[model samples]
Target: MHKSIMIQGTMSNVGKSLLTAGLCRVFKQDGYKVAPFKSQNMALNSYITEEGLEMGRAQVMQAEACGIKPSVYMNPILLKPTTDVGSQVIVNGEVIGNMKAVEYFRYKKTLIPDIMKAYEKLTDEYDIVVLEGAGSPAEINLKQEDIVNMGLARMTKSPVLLVGDIDRGGVFAQLAGTLMLLTEEEKAIVKATVINKFRGDKEILKPGLTMLEDICSKPVAGVIPYVYLDIDDEDSLSERFVRRKEGGLVQIAVIRLPRISNFTDFNALESIEEVNLSYVTSPAQLQEADMVIIPGTKSTMSDLLWMRQNGLEAAIKKLADKGKIVMGICGGYQMLGDTLTDPYGVEASGSLAGMGLLPMDTVFEKEKVRTQVTGQVTSPVGHFKLLEGAAIEGYEIHMGTSSSKSGGISSFSRLEYGLAGKREVKQDGYIMDNILGTYVHGIFDSEEFLEGMVKTLLKSKGLNYEQVKTVDVKAHKEEQYDRLADTIRQNLDIEFIYKILEAGV
Candidate 1:
């Protein structure tokens, strides 16, 4: 039988994802077949599996760390928030329906069977499964209906390690208060407590650790130091949004949509030293940016309307008209078109005018397109001219189709499904003189794609750019997994974790 352990957090963004990933790596390094599992994930950042299914990106990252292929079983329930209190609920990698927060809380109980099915499949295939919890288990109001935290641990009979973020302050209270809030039965599943994102001398933290353990009645598993590993963040709380704009050779600004999804597409460009990426939210921040990009959004029409209301749409149009390079991906690609029609009212009812930068029209459909893709660039001009003929591979996840109205303008890329499939889509996105848009989300992930983009973006700024060092994103990720494992192994009691797994709750 497969052994299991789960990482639960005191609150959101408490490093449960990273810790789970680290443990996965450690288990893999110790010569055990491992996989990552999360009963329910609520995040905008998602990934498309090889089988054309969708799952949370965090579990995908953890799967990478474990050196295993990601499956929908890793994240059976994905909630992509569309509005303040409503989200599109996806089960087994397909959309079920949109539900309000309260509705999901009441309806999620019905999904416990689906969760167990996925969990059982993973356990049967792997020697160990490292599960991750969503949000805090201390939320007394959400405890009863929860399928993600203590509930999942109970279901799997898996021991839990609670993580508290020291960087956020009140590490002790965060840890102790969580234990105090949980029921006695819930507390029994907690194996240990980990302090994440610590930045101080260990000696100075000794006394606090003692008091924390005393208050929580749990051993301190580890004090993980602050790490700056380049990994994809799962949601809007990503630290990348608050980074200071650097004066690199190329200045790229991505409009921070209210409902942005999969901003990790730009991770490769951000990794380049000569490229400075800033998440701009307003017209003022776009003033000095050489390239303005509108990223994918959960609610394209609503975000587009938001841009129009806040003068961002006008600013982008003005820049595009002035010969500045402007680009869009997925929903942003849809918004760049001349018109957006939603006869099915997927995002909203009726049709709306787009920014009119690209000569295309988008029609939102009821069904969503989710697939991994590969292709070569056919028509790349303006800032992307160097990328022409360069090989590109990525995934597509969108509910709208963008068709070119101008027959003269060619496609941005010629694509085929990355995995074997019978459905052959001839074209993707629309291309023009200085405006390019695509539904491909991870186009920049490959080495060739990044090389062309970085060199061109830098050369446009009058700087001679060269690839003095080649970076393979896949290789870099492997190195990061090892680094993360080394860090965690040095701090955490891995032997204790082994014991917890052996003695399942």
Candidate 2:
């Protein structure tokens, strides 16, 4: 039998995603095959799966914790918010079109079967499935057609663990009031209550915890401490200005464009103790950094225009000419070429001049290139010839293809590119000294690639360098989750939770 647990928050940003990931890791470590599930998630931060479908990055992070490849099934319903009140709804990995709040609420009930289908598929494959609920379940106004919170719990007949943010204050009111508002059926599904993001000593809150349990008639599961794990957050709430640690170190500036798409590319760098990462919006801020990185953008042409409007275009040129290392990924890679031609107006407007740093041009194609690639770099960079035979693996999701005049370096080829009598190099990928651009996402995860870039930066500074290795990220994440699970196990009413799990709703 596939046992599952649902983690629901009393409010948004109450550590629902992190708790789900922790549970996934915990179950996996307990010798159970586990999978993460979210019926619906609304976030601008998305990740392209190997199947070329877009899903919330939170599920991808949770899947990583379980040591599994992320799949579209993990997040069956993704709502990419286009505005404050509207979102582009994706159903079963395909876009169904944009809808306003009311329209989605009225239409969401029709998707229950779809949600069930996806959930069943996951349960059939895994020994345990950890379901994550979005926002608060006590929002009675949305309960009519809700499929993400208590409604989903009712559908799966899974035991629910209500989590409240003690760090946000009003822990007692948030827990007590939420329980008072829940329907009796919905309330019964909640087997245990969790107090998350507690900062100080747990003993001090004993009376409060007892009072909360007495009022709600539910067992207090755990009071989890606030953990700052270096994982990718998939919502706007967690996406904020991360302060640069105070230290004299190598400074790298990333242009925080208005439409920056893949900012998660820099998460690994942020964790490096010797590197300082800053997101700059103005051209003046670019002068204080040792290296400038133009991150990926969803709308390349518009962001290029944004750069030109803000005078950052000239600033980047000056930085490049001064022998500063400049890197771009995906859409940012497309912007580094000679010109960007969108004659078909696929992305936006018309053709425009690119930064012209490399002898290359990018053309927007109707068909997007999305794939998981594995290869090694074969380019000459001073005496090191960085990444000559180093194995690198990452995914590519873009609609533009690049080409160079003197022939491009071999990276990896798609089956279509190969069978069409075309080489991967000709499909628009380029690399040169101190400048590298590619359409592949998540390439920085490769230690070989990061070390190579670090070496190049050190060389540019005329300083001797030795590659400094950090912790293995995958192992580190698993260990973090293990710690979280241990904490939960020690504090929660495990017997009561197990009894609820055993008794189906």
Q: Highest TM-score, which number? A: 1
Global Cα lDDT for candidate 2: 0.78
Instruction: Say which candidate scores most in lDDT.
Output: 1
Flag clash pairs in model 1. none
Provide TM-scores for the models.
0.97, 0.88
* Tens-digit per-residue lDDT, 1-505, candidate 1: 8999999999999999999999999999999999999999999999999889999999999999999888999999999998999999999999999999989888999999999999999999999999999899999988888899998899999999999999999989899999999999999999899999999799999998898888878999889999989887888999999887465667899999999999999887777777789998899988887788899999999999999999999999888888778889999999998899999979887999999888788889999989998888888876778888888888999998877775523587888974575757568777777788888998889778778877766666767776524479999899999999999999999898999989999
lDDT of each: 0.89, 0.78
Tens digit of per-residue lDDT, candidate 2, span 310-396: 999889889888778787888888888888988776666478999998788888986656555656665545433645655455667
Task: Tell me how candidate 1 scores on lDDT.
Answer: 0.89
